[model samples]
Target chain A: MVDWIAAFSMPLIQNMFIVAAIACVLCGVVGTLVVVKRMVFVTGGIAHTTFGGVGMAYYLMSVFAVSWFTPMIGAAVFAVVSAVIMALPAVSRRMREDSVIGVLWSVGMALGVIFMSLMDRSVVTPRSFESILFGDILLVGNTELKIIAVVTIISLIVIATLFRDLQALTFDETHAKLSGINVTVMNVILYVIIAMTCVVALNVVGIVMVIALITIPAAMSNMFTESLKEMMIVSVILSLIMAFFGLIISIGVDIPPGATVSVTMGVLFVVAIVVKTAFGKITQGKME
Target chain B: MIPIEIKDLSAGYDGRAVFSNVNLELRDRDFLAVIGPNGGGKTTLFKVILGLINPMSGTVKVFGEEPVVSARKIGYVPQNENLDSEYPISAREVVLMGMRSKKGIRPFYSKEDKEAAERAMEYAEVIDFADSRISKLSGGQRQRVYLARALAPEPKILMLDEPTASLDPSMKDCTYDILRKLNKDGVAIMLITHDMSSISHDVKRVACMNHRLIVNDAPEITQEMIALGFHCVPELVHIGSCDCGGHNHG
Candidate 1:
């Protein structure tokens, strides 16, 4: 019912697809690790906490005229810093992990709200608020695409090089420690890549929806996978499918692409859970 | 050199020591069982020997070197933790994971690693489930997989933390048989257990710790060791006699 060729003809749509593919690969890989490590809450904390960096970047750019300080760079720095802080022995020893995360999550968003509010009216764009909070994937240019591509390439390389170590660490920490793998170093690497992927994911799904995009597809794939590698592969494919369809549906309905993608993924996740449960029950009945 | 040597060792958290004046040794092909109450510094001793925690005083050595310096010569299995049933790793994959170290960033496992994993799986009697999902296997099968993971590294000594805590009698015997076989193959074995019920027939040396070490060189667990190490020993309702009040020997 839609003009498919006409949609593909648009440079904006093409660019959106490119960025979504790269970002999804990044998200899918990191999200799989986060899920396996039972650290979805950690990634959620990283994504939301990085918003403080975004607000800080805006503050510097607007008031101090620091043109070189981009919001993406700020997000990356903040994410890594937040992850390292959480990994610190002192912080973990003194406070409950969830408590630290909850505090950071709230304070970061609040800071972003205040910073944006204090910005000059002239500096504020018509779509900045909506786009930054929820994504405007269509607005991503070559520069944004290039940055995400580089990040994805580098992250994938690091993940590949350390895949075995990461597997051991995630599979069993005590065993990994006994086997001579530095558990601390592996945790640092996993968190660093997770934070960086979250920074790139922000451009596609924004701060509020970044967690869902990174988590849902991988989680959905996780339901059907028999291995970590299989989970990531399927997760990346599912993410691509979801992103493309969500974009089409959003364009058709004039809704936000980020919200559309999130809703679509959420619906699929519920359906997958239902089917998995039903299948399991059926098999159990047969065996009995 | 002795596989593990601890002399007058004391370890704890903060500035205060939890247990002190400890002396122990793990010799070649030794099957030693360390038993005590929970929170009686059993895990602390394991940590100290694994170089995870520094001893407050005295010394601990592995192969005549510091614990950290010779850590690679030992394979360790902690208390059974349920790996996420949803995690989709195979038994063989789990075995292969043990071949990794912090030495270098190698992306793929070599053929030698695969062969070593296969051999370990065979040794642990888990080759039957090597291709199966780890979570799909039974408890005994899963335990073997974990054992295979420990064996994959081919260490000179094996340290286990309550390995039979959750297993049934038959499975426990099977695990003990495997440990005995591994011991015969020239690997020193050190096991930590909270109860004597799980201690197998082949465990010859015993150590108990409440606030201090009580090493029993003989084959039996003496009443004095139980009285000092455990707070309240369990009474056996099945038989007329209590378990910890007399000598435990087969």
Candidate 2:
């Protein structure tokens, strides 16, 4: 037992824990906004569209020998830009929002596949695609953990400073606009924040399950709290617990941490819904 | 002084004109009721005044400034349109939003703001439900709460779209009583409704609209005018005698 614990205490495992904790915090905070604003679909759209950025980064990496951060930066930029474009008045007017998201999703997948086909034949490996799909938690080095820490801290500060504005905007957009809150600007800022969260969380939850990480905990928290601030705190705690449990389970069973985290969150969500309903029925029965 | 003035205003949606070349003026303390048919442009006119949509070619001013620039002096009550009642918001919080529009980024409501909101709630008779969740209120009660929210801003002009649309007879009377009192308190009221007969007794002026300003007259709707303006013969319509009991219309 002591030998196993020592083996798990390596720098790689420590780095993974730190990076996962930061990603969980960031997703929990921003996920509350996404749930309240009914932007789960938009977050899904950005998540899928990030593949285009990955493709762009891969194509440029061979030519310029850029670092690993280049892909994440490209993904963040594309996600934010695509989100803003979809939200533009003209695009929203010309096409239904869901249809626009569908178009972007297909285009992004196509671009990613084409770029993969064009990659150097010798470098073609199953693990490279696996990293994009399921993520490689073992790759979270100290530098990656530091980057995640900085992003998580900045996100926390920004959300705290604009808490009131975000609350007002989420509850009622017209009222927020009338209050001179610049609803458009605030919405853009929120999209940018969500985009950054998507990029950061992609490393932990992977691209396919990013929205699940961003939505499940928040949805679970909503069943218990009415206040937005309280919901956010509860969601953050729940996500952190899930992340820790996922890491432990993955270490014990040799399963992927992302899959473990998502499955745990799903089970928690179902359990929360059942408990809430049972409690509600019990209270009503007692009142009667 | 006139708080709102529209001249040669033509507005529409999707390139199809709803109304054209409509001219109107709204003076201070004036309660003007815009009565029109289903496809008429009553709501469109209000949207235009609120600067939500632009007229194809015309000019509109609120308090001698463009309606968009002078939004501070105007409070709007949209029709009892379908709102997601499941949204967790209290009635007091809804009214507080009115004050927020006027006092942006103040961090806290002033004493004067609270007093004004309380007074508005009293006027709308929604004080009892101030702490209640908005979703729990009935249609009439919710309308009153919305009115209180509009009045919280203490605007010189208040515009409502079909405030009595879905109410029963008793609820309609109660709503009109509140509106009449608000009008008496010198808050200019602009109501858009299809229930012309219901509001004819309370408002002094009625503007009949179709694709244009058909008529902007005092509460003197005659059977002949209804026939001409609506292009339909009345079915057992009763034209009442005026308040002075001297001018009766048939």
Candidate 3:
């Protein structure tokens, strides 16, 4: 088994493991903000919008030579901008928030489809498009792994430095504002971090399942912990473990890693819920 | 000294006005309970004071400075509207957030800050539930936790929007008693309440507000005053009855 594991020929598969590990760690850190702010839907909105950026990059690459990092950077910037717009009217008018999110989600998906359709068929292959949709782990290179590592480290540092402020904003905005914290600034910072996570996870999980990878682990961890710090730690551990297991299984079965990872997270969430319910009932019985 | 002064303040939402040409002065240590009908703009007026919403035209001054400029000096307890009850945060953590707006990016809480939070919890009578999750608390306990969170900043002026709404009679009394005690301790309070009869005896003054302001001098409310304050519209008066059982409306 050790010799077989060593015999794995593809360098891209090693890079894929490195990239997935980095992405999972980053998701664990930044996903806490998305969960605490109740911005799970907003993160979904941003993830969907990133497809438009991907389409734009693909179309532009046909005419102008573009590096691999260009599309990811473009997608990250677009996602952050979309997050800012979502936060604006949503924060001001309480009633129109959901409607605004829905409209933005539809617009983003529509823009992605339109841009993809406009691209020349000869330059942008259907298989390449399929790779973008479901993610191709075998395509991850050393450069992608490096980028993910830098992003994960920076995001973790920022989150650590601003953890208290984020906690305050998450628990109570008005109270945070009254204490002299600029609630708007904190919210914008959070969205930017979330956008970065979306961009990083896009390569690993694809657009459709990025939100699940970001939210599900956090939600599952919530069943076991009370403190935000504990929730974040548990969430990261859960995400990494799930990612490792999913990658191994995908390699064995020759299946898509993103779908496997998402399914693993979903299973974990269901198990968490059931176990939490049973434990709660046992505690109640003991109390009686 | 008057911590808050509203001079000829006429405020409302959209294009229509709720209260117009209103004048009020809240001195330090004044626990002014704003008792009026349901659609009377009491909460709107407080929102205007808090700078959450701008008044169509009027001046609101806190400590002789604009309300927006001196936001730190004032704390607010908003009505419990759509707060996810199942959110996993402790009561102490909630109260600690009150200091976050002032602390900014300090990244660490000082001994003084922790003590202030503890004192606020004690003042709000929720110190016992400090480690408990907010979702686990009862309505009365949750209300106190929110109050503790607001008071954690040690603001000179505290504004509440319907603090007693949907609470039991005993809970309402307990909340009011705590407010009365805070007022005595020199924190000027502006409470927007629908429970007029219960709060009328405790408050020093009352203002009847609807589409416009009608500042009344009398301590006790009368049926005639309710008629004039609500613009004598039978439909508007009918809506007021559903709020607190026609206590202030006769």
Best by DockQ: 1
Quote the lDDT for B213 in model 2. 76
Q: What shift in Å separates residue B220 of candidate 2 from its native position after superposition?
A: 5.6
**Global lDDT of each model?**
0.81, 0.77, 0.76
Candidate 1, B147-169: lDDT as tens digits: 88888879888998887766656
Candidates, ranked, TM-score: 1, 3, 2
Q: What fraction of the reference structure's interface contacts does model 2 contain? A: 0.18
> For model 3, how does the per-residue alpha-carbon lDDT over B94-208 read when each residue is reduced to its tens digit?
7887776556567788888899999999888888778887777776678778888789878888888878777766667677778878888888887877776544556665666
User: Between the candidate structures 1 and 3, which one is better when assessed by lDDT?
Assistant: 1
TM-score of chain B of each: 0.88, 0.87, 0.85
Which is the winner by DockQ between candidate 1 and candidate 2? 1
Evaluated on chain A only, model 3 obtains a TM-score of 0.91
Model 1 chain B lDDT-worst window of ten? B241-250
Computed on C-alpha atoms, the DockQ of candidate 3 is 0.49
Q: Taking the tens digit of each residue's C-alpha lDDT, what string does model 2 give over A123-170?
A: 423237677766777776666677778877888888888776777778
Clashing residue pairs, backbone N/CA/C < 3 A, model 3? A179-B101, A179-B102, A180-B101, A180-B102, A181-B101, B18-B211, B20-B212
Q: Estimate, for each residue in B1-250, the C-alpha lDDT of model 2 and write its tens digit.
A: 6889999999999988899999999878888887766687888898888877778889999988886677657877766664545455666767777887777765556888888888888878878777776666777777777888888988889998888787666667677777788889898888887665555667877777777775545765655446535775322223343221111110
Model 2 chain B, TM?
0.87
Please provide, for model 1 over A113-203, each residue's C-alpha lDDT reduced to its tens digit, 9 standing for 90 to 100: 7876775557634248678878788877787788889989999999898888888778887667766777777888888898898889988
In the order shown, the chain A TM-scores of the predictions are: 0.94, 0.93, 0.91
